[model samples]
Structure formats: structure tokens, C-alpha cells
Target: MTAAGGGAAGEVDEGPLDEIDRLDAAAYEAFMSEVYDALGGRGRDLPARELHGGLVEARGAVHRAALTAEDVATVLDGSLVEAIESVGRLQTQLGAVGFTLAREAAVRGLHRDVALSLTDWLRVRCPWLSTQEAAQITEVVKACDSPVTAQIGDAVRDGTVPLHRAALVARTMSRLEGSLDVDQREAYAEIATRAAGRRDLADKDLARVCHQLVEDLLHEAAPGERERAAQELRSVTTRRVGPGLTRVTIDAPDGVAATINGVLTSSLAAPAPVKDEQGQVLEPDTRSPAQRRFDALATTIQRGVGRPGAPPSTARATVLLMIPFDPAGGVPSGPATTAAGDYVAPRQAAEVACSADVTPVWLSADGAPLALGRDARYATPAQWKALAVRDGGCSFPGCSALPQWCDTHHLDHWARGGHTDVARMALLCGRHHTHVHQHDLTATVSGGTVTWHV
Candidate 1:
């Protein structure tokens, strides 16, 4: 073991390494070939565990390796271990083909059974494939079985068997399995029964050809005829109801649209109209009959056009009335009851006015209404823009809704005493406006912060 001698310490041990590499390469090729052959078959039989064990042992000889019973079980139960091992070897020969060992293993594992069946069918139908060619053919088959490979499979099953025929065939078959209706299934069953007698075609090819024929026949049928046939073959069910206070019914295709009917007659022992402080009837104080009718028509139009929640477009019929000072003493300016017990505030008035579908009224204080009016000499458009910009959509908490979906809200009650100014005004959607008064929510403006006490 001296230096410069044949058996010296400096001498490298390359023989075993080279031999191991060669044997590993051969083992990988053999494994890949067997996998391809298995996929070509009907895949009814599982790959022998002993064969897998042997391959695993051979792989270990190439690189010191170990596998537990669980690992072996995993591989046997269609895990990517085998594909990983094989692809690793493939990478050595082909310089990293971008396909990862795990990915290749997982893909092959998932489609192993289908691939086996495909290989068997192809072998019977096209027996001229070389060993390497068949492996490549099986790979192509796996690729064509993807969801997007419909046209590829169509070409193959339709008798134009290309290089990657198995892939297209598998994809088409998978698609048919997903989309087949009752009639289609029956047709397929008939075709399958007829094709069972044809010995010339492979079983997979027979199934594929039958599917193709059925699809073509369906496609060639007249559109109306097909629709009628489909309708006849399908069953539909609907619910029925008896008449009630709230009657709802959906009409047939040839009849009227859906309808909801309700009675508007007064309830039993209806309360008499109350009188104001001056003995004037305190009936619902609302817009004129024409205004109400116009509003109803506008609302119907908006709803029909699917814009029910759209904000008011113009200030035409909209009005903001501010009392500035109480007509009578003792009541606060924000929200108070009048001597006649009527809520004379602009917010209340707006609610009553808008109920009849009049223009949206923004009731506020601090001279906000003066600034919001369209006439610049009285209240410039610039002032309105400034107010709109400052409010920044609806001021309702947790509701940063768009300006198109909002209406101006008056912070203080306008009837008792409140100015119509920006300081006392905030933007609120119609829904939030109703919620602030009708619901238990309270909205207040102080120090530029719009606080909503939910």
C-alpha cells in the first residue's frame, strides 16, 4: 500500500461505482418497461408485491436505501415511490426533464389502473410497438386522459389513431362517463352490448367507439326534435298551494308572470283618525295624489330595471325644512314631539313624504340644506359637492357603502329648531336612514366623527 504502487492508498475505487450506475440504469429501464406493460393491460390484476420488493432492493444496491413495511405498502397501494425511483434514473439519462419524481409518481399512481387497461387494449389493437415505443405510448395515453384532451381522444376512437391515441381515448371516455344522461346511458348500453360481439376491436376501443357513435347521433338530430325528446325523457316536479292572505303563485311559460296578492281592507274596529292641536285631522300627511302615483311608477320602473337601491338622482321634489327655533317652547331641536304630539321634524316629515315615493329629502341643521340646493345664488353646486365629498358615502358604521347607494341624513330634528348645514348633516343610505329612527340604532355627529350607537 505504498505511494505510486498499484495497490497504493492514492488509488481510487471506481469499479464498483461504475458497475452500480450501470446496473441502476438497467433496473430503472426494466421497471419502466414493466409499468408500461401493466398499463397496457386491463389492469384488473394488481402488480405483485414481490416484484415491487425486488425492484426496491435493486434500487437500494445502486444507492444505500431502506424502506419500511408501511413504505412498501404505500408504494404497493399506488404511491409515487416507484415513479420517483424511475424518473430519478430517467433524469440521469435525459438531464432533468422538468418533471419531478414525486409529481411523476403521483400522476402514474393515480392513473395506473386506467393506464394498464389502456395498454392491454392498445397491445391487442396495435401489436407492432417496440419496447421503448410502448412505454412512450403509455405516457402519451396518460397525458391524453386529462380533462382537456377531448378532441385528442375523439380522433383516436373515431379510427384516426395518432401517436398519442390512448390519451384522447381515455379523456373522451372520462368525459362521456361524466355527461351521460339516462337516454345516453341506454344508448351506450345498447352499443356496448352490440360491440361485445366484435372481436376485432379491443374492449377499450369498443367502448370508445360506441360512445363516439352515440355522441354523433345526438349531435346530428334536429335541435327541436332533440329538445322534445329530452323533455319527454325527463321528469319535472313542482309544489302547489291553496289560497291565503298572502297568496303567491308562479305562472306557466304561456301564462302571466309570478304574482303576489294581498287584501288591503282595514282591520276589525279600525282606529279613528286623530286630530291635531287645532282640531285638524291628523291623517297621513303626504304628497299629492299625482305625486304619489308618479313615485309609484318611478319605483316600479327602478325595480323592473333592477335598481331598487339606487340613490335619488335629482332634488326636484326633495325638500329639507329646518325650524331653526322651536315654534313652541321646552322641546329640544334634534328629535322632539310637538304640542299636538306630532313629530314635526324634517327627518320625520321626509320619512312620511318619501313613503309615497317622493324625492329623497335630506333633513339637517347648520345651514346644510341651503348649501345642498341646486340654485347656486341661494346654495351653490360647489357647496353640495363639498358636503357630498365630506360625508364620503353613507355615514352608518360598518357601512362604507358607495355614494350611489346613499341618502343625506339630518343629524338634528328640523321641526323643533335645527339649521340645514353640513355640520349637522351626514350621508346615510335609505336603509340606514330607516334603521336610525325605526330601529334601536342612534346616529350622532360630534367633532367631525359620525358615531352610531348600535
Candidate 2:
């Protein structure tokens, strides 16, 4: 039977449908051209609608292609890398534009028209954005509003800097505001953003830059102020991130961090050789580095819980504080610093010296080591006992290790003319003992007081 109003069922005229499709394609082409024009050659000015449209088009194309892993492999290695990088760059560019628009919208009070605040509006309209992400964008927007940091925002919008780095710079700049004037802040911001633009610079490197700046500023602060700041900055927090998983966050000064890292990286913490019950070789450890570190931490904690006043079961490590003194005045020339470069105030150093094996080092005005305290290779039992009495535990800053868990370290290397006398020695934990050697640390003792120089 013939179908009603058609030659056959499921049949339709092709000519008019083809014309309609051609018109739709032309209209889409025109819209995309407008979008590209707005982007200014780098996708930097993509409006929300255009950006969403582009994403939709790309998604549709990807779905239509239905490419397989084999198809992906057909591309040359160089092409694949280039394509991946291009996509990443475009995404970054788009993100920058989004941040810029958010800032503009905030400035214009557009959020008040819809939601209570900018972040609230973003959370409401963009459910895909995580809370952290929305907050970060808001922070970026606020930072961009600052005159000093506006250039960093510009760099982000230009796709020259990543969003994370921009945020980091913003935080650093805020911290440095008390130390730097507007001009100095602008200069530092420029340098930071320029460095951020470099593809070779890692986030950690930028962080180091920020750290160095803070340290430099701290150097100009009073000893009491710096010490107080250091004390305030130290923190340790543990939170459960998932079932059976807890994230431990430790924020400490450079010196304390070095000490903690030293312990975690000690030979005792290294991946042990797997052995059978008969003590025969089995296989190398299969645990990841993180897992090994975790196990090492557990073991260290277990070993640290001996009798309250028990001496070490075995020989431990030693520590030394290197403080530079004026040869003429017999006074400290400046504040002492840890091997990791955290400054040590005189009061703190005095506390460490009372118990630490103290060695005096004399330096000329030009920082040349004119003379060192008596040298030592190893401390005698009497000397060790003296140090243990003098220093209750490890002499490293922020360490509370027991004397029994510490070693008698020579302030100066015995091989380099160091003496092992009680006055020239310190008790250091195994980890800090290694740190002293690795950093070639030195210190000074005068009038029963110890001072460390980085």
C-alpha cells in the first residue's frame, strides 16, 4: 500500500532539506567568524556565549568522529604533542578571559542583580565549578582590581601566566605589602609575573622566589619580630581527606623543615632490603617512595617512645651551631641562621647553646672564616655526657629529641682540625647530624652560649 502524501513510507524531498542545511552551515560559519574576531587571534576575549558555543561545537565534532585509540596513534608524535599543548594553551586562555570577565562583572555590580555576591552567582550559574575553583577565580578578580597587581592579571589574561601562579604572586604580594612600598611592590610584581611567564619555571621555583623575598624582608626586621613571626608561622594539622586516608600538613620555618625532612630521608627511613626469615636475600622493596616514607615515619615514632629518661640504645648523631663572632669584641656580629637559612635569634641560640656542644667561630668583616673553635673527630664519653647535660636533646632548632637519641657532633670537622672536646661538641639527632655534614654547617660557642650560622 502507498503511504499517505508520499511515494513511500519514511521518504521525503531531499532538495529543499539540502538547501536548509546549507543555510544553517553558512549561518554557523558567520557566528564562528564573529567569535574568532572577538578572541583577537589568541582566544583572549571569548565572551561567555561564544566560549560555550565553541565548547559545544568541539564536543559535537568529537562525538561525531568517534575516534579510537588506533586513530589517535595515527598522528605523528610531534603533531600529537603540539595538538595537546595547543588545547592546553587555549583552555588557559579561555580561563584567563573568564577570570577577567568575572572581575568586570564584579566591578559593574552585575552579581547584585542576580545573586548576593560574585562567588554566589558563579556557584549558582556554573555548577561544574568546584567551590575551591570559584573562590580562586574570585580571589584572582580581587587581586586584579589592585593597582599593584593588575599587571599580573593582564599576564594571566594574555595567557603568559598560569592562574595558580598568579594567585601565588597575589598572596606573596599581599604578605610583602608591609615591607614594600607601592613602587617596590610593582617592581616585584613585574619580576614575578615575568618569571611566571617562562615555561621552564615550575610552581616550586616561583614559591622559592616568594620565600626568598620574604626572607630578605625578614632580614631587615628586628630579631624579636622575626622570631615572633617564625613562631607564629609554625603549625601542624591533620585532617581526614577520605576513608582510611589522612592528609598531614606541616608549616614550619626553613630550619625546622630541614630537620624534619632530614629525619624522613635518613638511612633508617630508606627502603629496606626485603629478606626471608632465614636472613636470605629476597627481592627489592616494591613499595612506592611515599609508602616507604610513611613506614619510616611510623618506625621513627615507635623508636622515639623509649623510657622517659633512657639513654640511647645505640650511638646517635651530633649537631653543631655555627655563629659568627667579632674577634675583637667577642660578640655576635649578626643573627645566626640554620643550614636551611631560617634565622635564629640570640635568645633562641642562647637556649640551644646551654645544652648543645658549642663551638666558637670567628669571622672577619668580609665574612671570611678567620678562625674556628677547637676541632674534634669524636667526643669522649665524658664529653658526650657533658653535652647531654648541657643540651637536653638535639640542638637543631625546633627539635625535642632525647639525649640518648643524639650523637656528639664536632662543631668543626676533625679531619679539618676540629677537636672533640666537650666545649667544641653538640648532641644532634641522626637526621640533623647528616644535615650538618651535608650543608657543611658551622657554629660558635662563647661564654657558654652557642650561635649558629647558615
Candidate 3:
């Protein structure tokens, strides 16, 4: 019922402190030492149970005694460092065992998708490991199989990467799965792993640095696609947050975005004071910036609604796409390029092709307008409204931007041979649209659910 190493009660000797630290380190080391003997030493073919049970019992007794120690503070302070170091080592070993089981499960062939296989076990019994942690550890274990990342993976196993950095490297490796070629992916994974292990990048910079590396590597891997248009979609929307409040978000191209932001700033900024009848200046208006902006918006809406030739029911909107075509039949052959000059991936393009907000138009290969009537090139406003109701928001996986804040993206480029029909377009918000084309990401849309490859 007391710290095994704490000397008799109220004895303020440094000897007890030293003893606690020593015992804590020794306990964890002893457990790991036994594991190495079983797995790394001779006669490693069979599983060793009794040795592990004995080690666990020994560690448990020490832990219990330390927890009840009269000098509990001293015991806890010294033991915490050792406890963390011990868990890192233990995680590495257990994760490796799980990796082996997953790899060998099929008997005839090895499976590389090993990390997810252990999530169920961790979710139920491992109180300390979160779902994310379980997945991260497994990912690090999987990284060991890659030749490029093997060295870094070794660092994780040896506790060199520690806790946070190990998670960073593991998540980066998972993200790079579809974004890079085999060699490039492996090489950067190693660099990420090594940098993380060495503490070269701070926790805040780890993800950003990894992201830049991924972007650079993607560009390096597919330099050919750089010149092709990457889709550029922008939108704006509002959401009702409460009984009397709403949230508005806007995403637009750089120039237009600046103008919009400028308007908001001017509206919200402090106003100049008015002069009194005697030409003396009065006190400046001191309302909150938010209140001013709200008033300005309400005024603007009133004026806009009363403008001549500006009808609330009808608006002219334009979408320009630079699509490729089959020269022989004037048919579309490739994904459409938005006026923003971004390319759409084929699968995502197909998703749009099945939506209700696009209409097809026929054009000559010689750049002349064909005899196709207006109905062939235009979708009714109602069709677009229906499309919004169906999609609800951005169609890309994990995106939650509302439908009103999305642009109708054409699957096949209109410039090539695609029609403007409702069945050939889908909605994409500005950010997700940019990301999709930036990495040339692959996504499959089925019943409105998107499956992103990387």
C-alpha cells in the first residue's frame, strides 16, 4: 500500500526519489527485455505466453504499489516519463504482431491493407488508444513494408519518433497513397518519417510540411497534367443558425472576391461623423462593426430589389467550359475544363453528367454555332433548383458546403462537344473544387456519395 521505493514515511531523503526513478525505468525495461527474448532470441517459432503473463503480473504489482505510495506525487512525477516511454515501445511491438497476423491471414498471399484489421480490437479493449490512434499505429506498422519508408518505420519501433510524430508520419503516409507513384511516394514517406523521428518539424508545422511535400510530389509525379485546366468553381450561400440569425459564406475568384471583401469592410468600418448646423463636428457614430454591416446589407438589398430591369425571378448566369471533343463526330471525349482552367476527373464528371442542372448543346467542329435550338442549350431555372434540392451541398466526399454555395460544374467541357443539359452537371464548392483539380484527385460518385482515392 505504499511506493516500493519511497523510504519510510516523512523521510525527505533524495534516496527515495532516485530509487523511484530507477525502479520505474527498470520495470518497463524488464518487460521489454522479456519480449525481445521471446521474439528476437532463439526458439522464436512458437508463441510465448507464460513469459508475457509473468512480465504483466510483475509490472502490475509495481504499478499498484507506486500508486498507493505515501509520496504519491514523487512517484507519479518520476513514473510518468517512464510510463510513456514504455507504452511507445509496447505499442510498436503489439502493432507489429498485429501487422504480421494481418499479412499472413490469407496463408497463400500477403495483404498490405493491414491497419484497419486491428481497429475493432483497439476500439473494445484498449482504453488508452483512440480509434484514430489505433489506426495510426497500424499505419506506421504498414509503412515498414515499404522499402523507402523502412528506416523511418524502424524509428517508430525503437521509440525514436515518440507519440505525436509517429502519428503525423503515419497519417501522411496514408494520405499519399493515391497521390504519388510508388517510388516517389515511398521516398517522401521515408523523408516524412525521418524528419518526424528527428523532431526536425514542430507539431504545428508537421501537417503543413507534409501537405506541401504531397503537393510538390504530386506535381513531380504528373508534370504532364500541370498545363491542363484544373477546375475552378466558386459559390456563395447562407445558412440559418438560429431563430433570428444566419451565416453567410462566399467563395469567388481572386479579383471578384477582393471586391466582395472590400464592400463588406467598407460597410462594417467606422463611419465619418456628421457636422452640426453651426458647422461644428458631432461625435462619431460608435455602433459595432457587425451592426453597421448588417444595416448596410439591408439597405443594399432594398435598393437592389427596386432597381429597374432587375427581376427577382430571372437572372442571367454564364458557365464556360473548355472541353475536348472527337473531331470526327463532334462528340465529347474528355472531362470538361471550367473557365477557371481546371480539369475534372472522369468519374466525377460522370457524376455531374447524371445530375439535373445541365443541358447539352451541339456545336460544329469549325467553331460555328450549329442549328440546335435554344432548348438544346439551356436548362430551366427549376431544373437547377431541383439539382440543389437533390445534392443539398457539395458532392465531393467529406465536403459540407451548402448547395447554394456551389457552382454547377459541367462534366464534359462545353467547348468540346458536351451539351448544357441538366444530366451533365453537378455542384462543387470553391475549396473542394480547387483541391480536386489541384492533385488531379480521383473520386467515384454513387448515389451522391463520393469515394476519394487519396
| lDDT of candidate model 1 versus the reference | 0.45
Give the number of the best model, judged by lDDT.
2
Candidate 3: tens digits of C-alpha lDDT, residues 233-315: 24455757999988886546456667666766773444756789997778877777777776666666678666643121123
Task: Give residue 42's lDDT in candidate 3 (0 to 100).
Answer: 50
Error of 2 at 267 (Å): 26
Give the higher-lDDT candidate: 2 or 3: 2
TM-score of 2: 0.40
lDDT of 1 at 76: 54
Question: Over the stretch 1-454, how does candidate 2's per-residue lDDT look in tens digits?
Answer: 5554565766654675476576677787776678778876555445756868977887786577555898987989998888789777866876887787788888999765532346656776677876666766776777777798889788888888878788778767766665666897898888878887888988899889877777776687688667655655466757579999989977687788787788779876677887999987799878888887778777777887743432431223244455555555344556665555666664344333333244434456676766644433335556667788888777765445689878766686543455667788777776666556545567777766556565
Give the number of the best model, judged by TM-score: 2
Runs in model 2 lying further than 4 Å from the true structure: 1-66, 110-120, 224-454
What is candidate 3's local distance difference test score?
0.55
TM-score of each: 0.24, 0.40, 0.35
RMSD of 3: 17.5
Q: Which ten residues in a row have the lowest lDDT in candidate 1?
A: 255-264
* Model 1 backbone overlap count: 20
Error of model 1, residue 359, in angstroms? 9.0
RMSD, every candidate, angstroms: 27.6, 24.9, 17.5
lDDT of each: 0.45, 0.68, 0.55
